[model samples]
Target: MISFSVDFWYAGIGAALIALSLLAFLLSKRLLKKLLAFNIMGSGVFLMMVGMAQTQNDGAADAVPQALVLTGIVVAVSATALALVVIRRFALASVVAALAAENKAAENDAAENDAAEKNGAERTGSDTAVSDTTVTDTALTDPNLNKNGDPQ
Candidate 1:
């Protein structure tokens, strides 16, 4: 009369899913990240299946299921390795590009400072100061200058 059913609850697939979910949560950041989330998720699914195998009838585990787990592990490991290499290369390129952009910004700032010093000298009507070529070039080429100080 449905008096006992603890074994049925323990043998259900929910328990297996819970264990796999825990694993996936832990490995989601370090092993998966943005590139290989699907691969990591597949590995979690494989583990869930393996856990389910523990509840096989007659207390016997099947070889086919175990073999599938091994195959999936191999494929997942290879995919994870390849994705990590690609991500590393991408990060390196990003760093190089960012450094180049920073250097360009610094050069522009220096040029601006030189132009400001030239303007300040001109505003003081000083005739004994050295002429700044960078400021003259900007005054001739830059649209931000006037007809006298920003002559185009």
Candidate 2:
């Protein structure tokens, strides 16, 4: 007749797990910080529910809570997967957009350099208070060109 009374232990474990889970959810952690913490919280909740079931005089574990935990874990996995997919998509799109902008600038610069080769006078003089490049505000790189087709 030396059976242990697991009621107090089970209750204490359940309370601790619930408190920790809430703390994990309420803390001001960055959204992308890590996913391990969320998984740990889910585990804690599972344990807490299981421990609650154990608090009863029955020494055997129940099946309902275990099944619930399985379902919840599946749902969590789906949500995490979707979130990761979205983050990856956004990161890729940002990189592509930046590359396209750079490519456009390069094309513009090449066209200006070609015009300078064909029309030397428009790019190489400072005889006035404002050369063509300065008059049109070229300042090393220009978005507009003079009638002779050189960047200004």
Candidate 3:
């Protein structure tokens, strides 16, 4: 029969944490949340390692596992920082692209408005110009008038 010790309790807690972290990572949609889950999982693994190291015997603590856990922590922090930087760059790029598209659309609308205004001014100017001949409404209504508004 195996006797339960403090190490056993730590191991159980560590396993539970690892399982929870995995669940969180799998169900999470956001990158930041996934990153957090990953960190939690790492912590659980470290705890498990510590518990295992303490159970080695004679009540002597092992230095190798402790050192490894320390190194793992440093690596985890570096990785998290890098991930954050990547997310930031992606967000900034998306914002820049959206703003550029908006500005381009605004420029196109302004150009169209200017062109329409110019065309409207030309039409108004042409309508006001005097002509050599003019036709009356009665001439238009009368079928006797030729195509040029003259009596047939």
On TM-score, the leading prediction is: 3
lDDT of 1 by residue, 61-149 (tens): 66776798799889878877897886676455434433333343455566665443444323222323324542232233222333332
RMSD of 2: 16.4
Find the number of clashing residue pairs for candidate 2. Answer: 0
Candidate 2 residue spans exceeding 4 A from truth:
1-31, 105-152
- Cα lDDT tens digits, model 2, 1-152, are 63665744665665676676566555635444345456556666776677677656374677887789789989988978886886566456434433333443455676675554443333433325333533233322232223222311
Which stretches of candidate 1 lie above 4 Å from their native place? 1-40, 110-152
Worst 10 residues of 3 by lDDT: 130-139
By TM-score: ranked, best first: 3, 2, 1
For residue 150, give model 2's deviation from the true position in Å: 44
Q: For model 3, how does the per-residue alpha-carbon lDDT over 17-104 read when each residue is reduced to its tens digit?
A: 9999999988776778988999999999998888877876533677888899999999999999998997786556444433333343
Residue pair clashes in candidate 1:
145-150, 146-150
Lowest summed lDDT over 10 consecutive residues: which window, candidate 1?
143-152
Question: Each model's TM-score?
Answer: 0.48, 0.49, 0.65
TM-score of model 3 vs. true structure: 0.65
